[model samples]
Target: MSPTDTDALADDLLAYIDASPTPYHAVRETARRLEQAGYRALDERESWTLKPGERVYVTRGDTSIAAFHLGTAPVDRAGFRLVGSHTDSPNLRLKPNAQVAKNGYQQLGVEIYGGVLLHTWTDRDLSLAGRVVLLEGGKPRGHLVDFRKPLLRVPNLAIHLNRGVNTEGLKLNPQEQMVPVLGLESAGAVDLRAMLVKELSKGGVKAEAADILGYDLCLYDLQPSTRSGAHEEFLHAPRLDNLASCHSSLTALLTGPASREATSGVILFDHEEVGSRSAQGAASPFLRTLLERLTLVLSDGKPDAFHRAMAQSFLVSADMAHAVHPNYASLHEPKHQPQMGAGPVIKSNVNQSYATDGESWAYFAALCREAGVTPQHFVTRTDLGCGSTIGPITAGQLGIRTVDVGNPMLSMHSIREMACASDVAAMVAVLRRLFA
Candidate 1:
């Protein structure tokens, strides 16, 4: 691809992330694109009987989904070419009994659910979104709720009141500072479910509490991702840490009408922001169940064939890589600071935080080279603690050879994140080759 094409692709992907304000929207967009490409939907409750050349998709919850295509040729047990990414991002969340009033101010109590930069949430406009369950007549009605506009905010306390805020640094009390102002009035009794029901009803959806089986909901900034810098070198947005990977994986999945030479699969999961233990998370049965079921479908229930396919399978855990911050260059190891647009990164950790080992990294290095994308290496400072990811967990669970990789970015968990514009296209190119 030429530089112009790369810029076009980055612009396209940034638009997708900007449009996907919530996990539900992300999954919905993904499913819509896959279906447009002729992928059939499957019911999770029923057993799967897949035929060669058939393409299918499935979702565990609104937050996670997987799509794969069966090769027209015999299914290779050596395992499928699996690419994985997370759909969730760090943000404030509403509590079950969320409504509360203080000093005539109507606020919705929120719980800090994951590792987040709390200071970033202050004074920024926020919107409500997520899945809501309600009753339509007698049965449960599952619906998605998105305000898509500014609905609430966590106003910052006046700096004059805390003279030492900058000097001593700021500390936020999640229970206090994180509460989003809902309205001026109390809105009568706190019926959080009812309020949500009414919101969905506006979308032509009517339902009750029992009508709601359950929902995975979250609030997001309605801010759009923008191109910045004099040379248009920087891309700024929310959830870029993994969303970049998510968009790249989705694009790669579509670039193919892939062949039976290998089964290419993509897993966009939720709850990674909170350690991935949920049903739709990496640590759960979603990936394992789907892989096992796929193997059986390919082998026609032959255990030996499934085992062989497993041996041939490979997985790429696509998450965001940290680029060295120019302002904080001292924090990164001199030789290991991966630069923005330097290329795709192959992340490694001896502590097992990332799943990549000698063989897996080598395999990925070959793929990167074939795609003409430079591959870099990442390892945390030994003294500093390392963060964990699904790469390690999924590798252990499936015993599939795996390499962890990502696009290098900065201010990873910040409310608004930044990455190089060219890096997005670079990673997309590498993924296209991997899926190819």
Candidate 2:
């Protein structure tokens, strides 16, 4: 794969990721593509069935999923190749009993989830997306609800009123400033459950407050992702941090062969932005269980072979890398300013924030050569603390030689993020070659 090809696919994948506002939506999009490519879905209650030349998938608690293909020959678990990534990012999550009416205004009460740039969320055109629970004929039902259009806005206080805004740098009070405007008072008292009931009613379901199972809802910018700048060389979008990785792995699976002599897989996890400790997160049994089940099924009940394959597996933890900001260039290390379109990054930190080491880096560099990608290096400033990911956690849990990699991104965790347009397609092409 050439750099040009990777850049093109990156843009395509970024659009897909930007469209998925929640983990459920992310998994749904992935399932759609897999089904299109002739991959069969599995029921959790079904018995194990092993067959050669069949594409397989496993789901855990709705949000996390692992997909792989069986090769013509028996796969060596000891030499398996895996791409690991997460589905979650930093944002605001809706709280239960979320409706709050104040001074004739209707607002949705929300809690900050993960490490988010709170100030970036204010004054943006926002829309809600997540799963909704309902009662259909007295039974619980799940529905994917996406208010695609801009339905709310958290307006910032005027500069004239906030005399300290410029000097103090706009300190945001999450409770007061983050309230999203729903409708006018004449629109009547805004009951959140009632609004949900009304929306679910259209889907043939009767919903009540009690019928509301917890949701993973988020507010996102309503703007569509697109190429920008005079040369049309930059990509502007939201949630590019880890979504870029999710899209790349999914695209690689679809475009690459069904199976190879070695085991190849893609795992997308949830709650990575919040320390990855949930039931479906990197810290749980999700990945381990999926691999064990796959090995058991692929080995035709041969425990010895399955164990061998498990011992030989390798994983690539794909997350977004930080690019050197032109305005804040002083914050980055001089020698390690990872440039956009320079190629994919192998992120490293001595404190284990990233899991890449000498051995893992070398192996990935070899794979990049085979895939025709020029692998780049990323390191943070000496005086600052670095952000962590599922990379080190998964490495500690699975004992796999894991390499941390991603596309360089600017304005990370902002309501609207930016990256080079060419890098998107470049990543896809490289992933295709690696998966092959």
Cα-based lDDT for every prediction? 0.82, 0.79
Tens-digit per-residue lDDT, 51-144, candidate 1: 8778899987777889987766455543588899998888887777677888777888888767889999888888888877665566765678
Candidate 1 local accuracy as lDDT? 0.82
After aligning candidate 1 to the native by TM-score, how far in Å is the CA of 283 from where it should be? 1.0
Off by over 4 Å in 2: 1-8, 76-78, 136-139, 201-214, 300-306
Q: What is the lDDT of residue 267 in candidate 1?
A: 95
Query: Which candidate number has the best lDDT?
Result: 1
RMSD of each: 2.3, 2.3
Structural similarity to truth (TM-score) of each candidate? 0.94, 0.93
- Where is the poorest 10-residue window by lDDT in model 1? 70-79
TM-score of 2: 0.93
